[model samples]
Target: MGLRVQVDNLMEHHSQKSLFAVVLGEMQDGGLPHIGCRCPRCVSGRVGYAACLAIVDVRGAETAVYLLDATPDIKYQLNPLAEWLGPHPQRPNRFNPPTAVFLTHAHMGHIGGLPQLGPEAMAVDGLPVYASAELVALLQETRLWSPMVQGLALRLFSPNQPIPLAPDLTLTPIPVPHRDELGTGTFAFLINGPGKSLLYLPDIDSWQAWDAAHSVLQTVDVALVDGSFYSLAELNGRPPVAHPLISDTLAFFAGWPGELVFTHFNHTNPALEPNSGAVATIQQVGAKLAHPGMRFLLD
Candidate 1:
């Protein structure tokens, strides 16, 4: 399906007095049609934005929208939330910024859109951006990002501590192993709503590396996890990639009770092709591939 169609579908179902999670983008940081690459998926005009998620809470007088990550494709990703976000107070045709944004780590795709919130673009004032203390300090200390950081009220969140968004809605950050070049910790957010809980974990090094993987997965009703590469073949004989293979992920969650869903697909991932064997294997194991517009009701 086309991107517009997917986005329209996402905007179609917005129930009041409810909370839900929506898939804003399902591709890796580079996104589809990766820069300067002539791969089949890239050349075929197939498009996908970097991995991102949005949480919408409509249990009050006004709807509140929170984003899990501010990807490079954030502008397009936020378009579907226009109705919930409402119109900007001063801007004629623009929508207001999200209620807040939580960062998983300091990766390019995770924090790149921050510049868009600076004086150059949205110019949002005092936006609450939550992240690890180290990550927030990194952004504040970097001279190049000072302009954008200055406008944001960056808050530090500790691992495993829950931040309540509403009466029964809380978000807890759980540390995970990943490629950390800047000494900033990576986190997977577990969002607990009234009726259900969902874990947003788009990037991780591997399941085995994290001792709490099984325990954490068992706690949530659904998990949106890293599926960056299907196999080492996608690496073209290079060393193993940071993310765990889809096959291994399926095996790890074979008989789990909770829903297992995959996202953050790399351009070379064969699972991106609807008819690929990789996709078939995922389905056969009762797992799911996340697509734009996919929704999980939290309450």
Candidate 2:
């Protein structure tokens, strides 16, 4: 089905007891309209937020929302969840913060929006934020971010261990090979819900670098893997990019059982254009390009 139809179906069942994962943004870390470039996509005023996802559980008396990454576009990203977040206790015309946020790594697009939760903005109190031990230490040691870090209840999570969010929902962090400069490892979250499971792996150096890549992909119902670049030609003579090229990714997962969805696209990626040959190739292979508001039902 088309993405619009899928979104409508999810919204229609919002009141029912269900668990779903929604894409908040699907662009690469820099996001669309990249910093200084005047590329055709950027010059045309096309916009896309950084890669991020939110898991919503409506199975309990109160809905619970959890974020996969706190991107720079978080303010706009959170707008869609306003109805579920409800009103803020003391602030008018505002919504409550998410129940928690899970960080994949320390990239700017992954943890950049944290400043919005500090004293100057949302001023959230005791918000639960989960991340790797090294990442947590890095945030706490950064003097400039002390104000924001103070409000967060930073929790450390181990790789491959399941952290239960509800009786039927659990999130497991699986270490993946990625460019890590701070000695803080990267992760690809494996979310297990009541009826289905999903793997949110927005960034990875290459599928070959991870030993369990194929096995892990086979275990999930849906795999939102990295698609940062369609080809190295988009790099414009820069050094080789770390992410797996879309072409290689397609060949890597050909005939895999689980649904393969590509995301985290760079501004230069031709796949962003609906009619581009890259997109058509992906469609021909039964894979899909993820977009904002794309919903994957887990239960």
Candidate 3:
């Protein structure tokens, strides 16, 4: 089998999970079975949580778990990894929180689950959250979100600068063009593991908008990119949004050597259905559709 197939096969075995990155959720901000939408994909009962990735580093004796984004379905997203997180030292029923959370932008799906870390829910204390400098201020200085951030250890990171996690694991924030309504800026993370690199870019306006798209993507071993909408039809005749359609992305990066995986699907996306040709179409182009629990070893 090819490398892509090998990765897919390895991901299917849950018990053997090792140092890797797991695709936690594959839906867009609204997620599948969307808020009041009765689309076929929604009505069919096939749904997924918002786009999220979990990085598990077990290179050392102690395992470190880091989440890429805090989606609305964070409770479900983090539950399955309880073993890795281990039982909280102080809390009887709770598992330890992730090592860190890296936000992509100020979108609802990206930062929506942050409140869960506050007093009412997980009550995480001193948990590190890395984001753009502006985003750090917005979350820290804003009075409205003050309560939720009380226990968070906010860290500001500059775009294109590498934030070292472990000795060899580093996260380089790459500024990508996206609809920045709050002036907080947007970032796509380039996670460099000990032996491999991966890009967890769930949102971007357009590939053409970013001049550095090719070079950055080329360097990564795998890229889980945005697949918000399959076509303009999903828009329901509304004006085009900033996201790059899945069709456009496939053609744009068809020849790129890295393993490309489509994620962040809208509820209207036909690819969510098991028998849909859209899934086959992606495979035909040497790409794969991301599903929850899918794991990819960075090393």
The lDDT for every candidate, in the order shown, is: 0.91, 0.90, 0.85
Error of 2 at 155 (Å): 0.5
Q: 19-93, model 2: which lDDT tens digit per residue?
A: 899988899989988999898999987778899999999888889999999999988788767777779989999
lDDT of 1 by residue, 31-79 (tens): 9989999999999988899999999988899899999999999888887
Q: Which ten residues in a row have the lowest lDDT in candidate 3?
A: 1-10
Please rank every candidate by TM-score, starting with the best: 1, 2, 3
Which residue pairs of candidate 3 clash? none
* Superposition-based RMSD of candidate 1 using all C-alpha atoms, in angstroms: 1.1
Best by TM-score: 1
TM-score of candidate 3 relative to the true fold: 0.93
Name the lDDT value of residue 264 in candidate 2: 95
Give the TM-score of each candidate.
0.97, 0.96, 0.93
